[model samples]
Target: MSSIAEQDLADRRARAIQQLLHTPLLHRDTPSFDTIATSEQWLKEWFLRTCGWILIVDYRRGMARLRKVTGWIDSTHPQRSLRTGKSTFTIRKYVTFCLTAAALGEHGRSRISLQDIAVAVSDLSVRAKVSPFTDLDHKDRQALVDVLMLLSALRVVTELDRTGRDYSVDPTGNVLYEIDERRLGQLLVAPLPPARCSTWQQMAADPHPQPSSGAPLDAHRLRQHLMRRLLDQPLCYLSDLPDDDAAAVSDHTEHITQWLSEAGLALEIRADAWMVVNRRAGTARSLRDGSNVSNCALLVLPQLTAQPSGWISATHLATLVDELLDEYPWWARSLRNDRNRADAVATVLRSFDLIRPQSDGWRIMPAAWRWAARVDPACLPPSSSPIPTQPAQDDLFSVEPTHQ
Candidate 1:
């Protein structure tokens, strides 16, 4: 192929991979479905080879799914609401989601009424001895509606009457839905059937288990595990990984970098860590956004980097936040009196692996140096220096090596 043609193919494949990473479940209505469908073969081979993830593209069903599994349980990414603001699913909503799925799976019709599904869900909950759903309780009714909305988003069900919201408000109100049984069946992607698995560990077990002794023949497994960590996490610390996996990373750094580059991700290698930086947008989370939490995190970056020992006490961070609130009067007004603002900022920072929770407080990670504000010596006062001003742009994953 010509250079131009090869570049175009690479870009198309990269876009498809990014879309799958952001939203693992893709349906006919998804904007990037055409690119994903066209490059299905490449995507399948790439995901399987790189991360051992399964990529299923059903052209007949007009949907695609990437079954991704990580070495550890990741609580950072959660099934969020489809509405504006995108609130994370709560425990109640999660329970309702499973019950609703079971109800739909057991129903014997292609078309079912919203009220019927609710009744079925309540029945299943009672039989399972879980919290029974009651229309009398507004919270229960809302949770059911949320689950339906989520299903609708996944294209498992189509709300024919568009009155699903009404059921949440009024117990008597109902809506009709057309169920897609095939899509419903594809929802669960576990290594073992959930029925046979008694514990979460069993459910998440890898079917192709790697040898514990790290034999040369099983080197591919180590590579897959390492790639999965680099792609799925914000940062892959050598200390956080198993000894075998960490050794594999150090031994085959160039090979891993080439694999990531094919998917339009840059592999950032550090003495103690590695991180995959997306070349394109929409593939990863943004920490420089205009949200209150992001802004707070940015404001506190300087304080974290200024610590001589890289460790700061929780009480000290809270006091810093109070002083910041007073210094920047125009900052997030809602957090002005919120005592938990410090904790919220810490959570945001921790999500990016910029800081880690220590026994005493939080310790700033090496990766945080990329976003830390630098003080200007020329403008420093004789007695004390003001809070350092942040750079004009906080480019994600663009940083200099902290160590030689």
Candidate 2:
């Protein structure tokens, strides 16, 4: 081999050695079956959660921890996992995510639940539009539980408590399982840095100030702010962002999209506006009125129009008014007549990159206008805020933002 190739191999070996030695689960061989493999996977998952990523464990990118503790692996020869199974023969993705999130200690208590997992999984399977759902039986549920129990036997996780959910009427209701995270940190203390794309630097090309970790607010708004920041362009979307983060929009959008059809939103590729229809529960008026769904519609709608083609005339476009009215009939009745309402909504839409104007009418941006809108409205220079008349200052802080 070339010297460079040899050196590269040696470097990888050294790093792998460092990873094993530094991580809590050091190389230690032991006898384990399917249950054992499940347990190890749980432990590794927990390690990930403790470090700040919530990943579901079931059928995903096909990662399986085939064996724990391969013995005497060295540069010359790689160690092979002793035990192999024909099928993956392990826990589902949802259970793994719960295990890992629970392993993050108290920080994860709110989100880790059987209902959450089921909803998340069902939603993912549904949104992905890939299931008949009739085939899974009680045996399937038990089999999943058995895998978790196996994880416990392998000393991968400790069960803190268990509670039954009553679905007594028919098939199944709900079940809650609780897990402990005391051991996950053994693997988490010195985790490696995330992949290059997962960094904040990747999102913010502008050197705008970062939010303090302690920033206070509602989770969704925070997520919206982040969505605006990270997803500034056409190709950028939450699916393109991290699934785990304090930002509410990213997390909630990802969470809901898994259950709600990506089709549920009324975003047509042609229109720059986003519309939401009732997936469930609308008042007789709402079915016709479309308001409560409207608030949510407004909240989520701006997200759809990422790339606006041109200027939109509010006078010409009564559709926004009608849609808003349908979503919030009561509020719409009151707000429609407000003098500055159209301009206000238009400005906000512009900030959100939802709308633009063409030669004649309003146009929608197919890609998100989110990134350009990342700056908080409060951060906008005031009317009284002097424009830097000086050419250099004006040039430096120009309204035109580079896509970088």
* Per-residue error (Å), model 2, residue 49: 27
| lDDT (10s digit) by residue, model 2, range 231-331 | 12212233333344433342354533322222121111111222222232211112122333233224323433321433445563445545544444444
**Which candidate leads the pack in TM-score?**
1
lDDT of each: 0.77, 0.35
Candidate 1 structure quality by residue, lDDT tens digits, 1-404: 99999998887787778778878888878777888888888888999888888999998889999987874777766777775244678888899998999999999899998889989988999997898888888888878888888899899999888553477788888889999998898898777768899986898897776566755425677778788877777578888866666676667776788887777778777666787777575555567655776776777777777788889998998887777666666657877766688887887888889888898799988778666654333322233335545553334334443211
Q: Tell me the TM-score of model 2.
A: 0.22
Error of 2 at 39 (Å): 26
Give residue 333's error in model 1 in angstroms.
Answer: 5.2
List candidate 1 stretches off by more than 4 Å.
83-86, 162-165, 193-201, 208-217, 313-315, 331-343, 359-361, 373-404
